[model samples]
Target: MAILKQYKKSDGTTAWFYKLYMGKDPITGKERRTTRRGFKTKKEACLDLARLQLEIESKGLNNNSVRTYRELYNLWMSQHTLNIRNTTEQRVRNYFTNQILPSF
Candidate 1:
């Protein structure tokens, strides 16, 4: 579901904003949220929300989001390592290689 808000921008123009619930994150199993800001009209926001709903229904909560767990894990690790410390990243890499990858 999505909720709409009418907010005044820094430039003093009123715009529509919406927060959409995009199901769970594949790696975290936590709620994933997507927000869009600065729509010119409420109707436009409504239309976009409708489109998202149709996509969710036609595909699934994940919306054909990813194909496999291994592929997903690889993609996740690639992005996750960029912001973390080197030692922590290496430890995670080792754990995945030694303990996790074998199970897959």
Candidate 2:
């Protein structure tokens, strides 16, 4: 869904803005939203919002993959272990392998 609103700019002029719901994050389960401002008129905001909706409808939000817990864990560990010490990294790997992977 999209919502349109008008607000006074710093120059004391009325401008239009829009708020759009993009959907949820697959990994975090959080609602995703985007806000665009500084449109000159409500029609301009509505046009931009319609274009964005068309793009999203055509592109489908880019969430086509279904990843398992192990895949997600490996992906996380690849980036997360970069700055950590080898011992700490090993501890984290062990914790995930022993305590986390089994439950999932």
Candidate 3:
């Protein structure tokens, strides 16, 4: 399906909003539904939707409380490791442990 659906933004600009059905909310005990909107094109809207889906599946986008920076750093460290040297990795780890972890 073509991802772009057009809608009017609050600023009166033409925009595309993607509508996806997210499953029900667990805590509020209410049926949950939301829309990701205000993109300028269908491609943008679809890409946004895909990102939202990924974040939701990854437990990074909690509806109740925002994720702490430490949690995000750990998540990033788990998923991404490129050609960086061991020293770089250690430095990153140390930074996270000392700076980010203590704040949250």
Candidate 4:
């Protein structure tokens, strides 16, 4: 289930509201809040809430795990440069050693 709430905006000219759902983090198993936008009209609010409800029902609400920099870089290299020739490999290695590794 999700939390439905409403409030007045800072300017007091408009009303803001939102629907918040609790989801567990996939990697950590920690509870996290997912909120949909607030709108002036009740229809708009309901529409946002319905969209979120659909997403939660279909996808389940776990955040995907993050990949470390090294992991990402290696994956990128494999996809982008692993097919290159030996000369290109040498150039890439030189660039990694002189530019990328030092900076990172």
Candidate 5:
């Protein structure tokens, strides 16, 4: 479910926002909700809310898929090495390959 409302901005202008019920946390068993604000008009807020609802319906809440340790390490390394020097990247890779990957 979603609730849409209008509010007065600091400049005395009206804006729209929506509070959406996004189901519960699978692990924690607690409710989840999301609020989007600062829309210029109610139509804009409703459009975004519809899009979000459609996305949740199509993809469902828990989107993660199981991955092996090696796959996870490779994915992490790809991002972790992007801004680091080549030597630092190699050192991190070596630590994972020799010490971490072996244990896992």
Candidate 6:
């Protein structure tokens, strides 16, 4: 869904804006939103919305798969260990799990 809006700017200039709902994030299942402003005409906003919708339909709502950070970390670790040595892999994995995955 998208809505066009008209508002007064801080400089007292009228502008056109649009808020486009980009659907839920696959990883978090939260609603995604995007807004663009400063369009001089509604036609520009409409055209941009059309382009965005096409891209969303072609690609996806969100690329992530609703996996938790731990799940994603394990998935990435599996791929990362494919060509690496066992010792180095363990060190790297430890670093990520301790210093990085927790943040996510």
Error of 1 at 26 (Å): 5.4
Mark the 10 consecutive residues where model 6 has the least summed lDDT: 61-70
lDDT of 5 by residue, 25-62 (tens): 78778998999999998899999999999998898877
Model 1 TM-score? 0.54
Question: Which stretches of model 3 miss by more than 4 angstroms?
Answer: 1-4, 8-13, 60-63, 66-104
Ranking by lDDT: 5, 2, 6, 1, 3, 4
Candidate 6 per-residue C-alpha lDDT over 26-85 given as tens digits, one digit per residue, 9 for 90 to 100: 878899999989987888888888998899899898665746888877887888899899
Cα deviation of 45, candidate 2, in Å: 0.4
Off by over 4 Å in 1: 63-104
CA lDDT scores, all candidates in order: 0.86, 0.90, 0.71, 0.70, 0.91, 0.86
Expressed as tens digits, the lDDT of each residue in 9-96 for candidate 3 is: 6778898886666666676556555777667887888788888777677873345452677667767787655667789898988987
- List the lowest-lDDT window of 10 residues for candidate 3: 59-68
* Model 4 residue pairs with clashes: none
Which of the two candidates, 2 or 5, achieves a greater TM-score against the reference?
Answer: 5
What TM-score fits each model?
A: 0.54, 0.56, 0.47, 0.53, 0.67, 0.56
Q: Whose TM-score is greatest here?
A: 5
Worst 10 residues of 2 by lDDT: 58-67
lDDT tens digits, residue span 1-100, model 1:
7899999998999999899998876767999788988889999999988888788778766645568777888899999988999999999989988899
lDDT, model 5, position 4:
99
Best model per lDDT: 5
Better of 2 and 6 by lDDT: 2
Model 5 off-target regions past 4 Å? 4-17, 37-44
User: Over 4 Å off in model 6, which ranges?
Assistant: 63-104
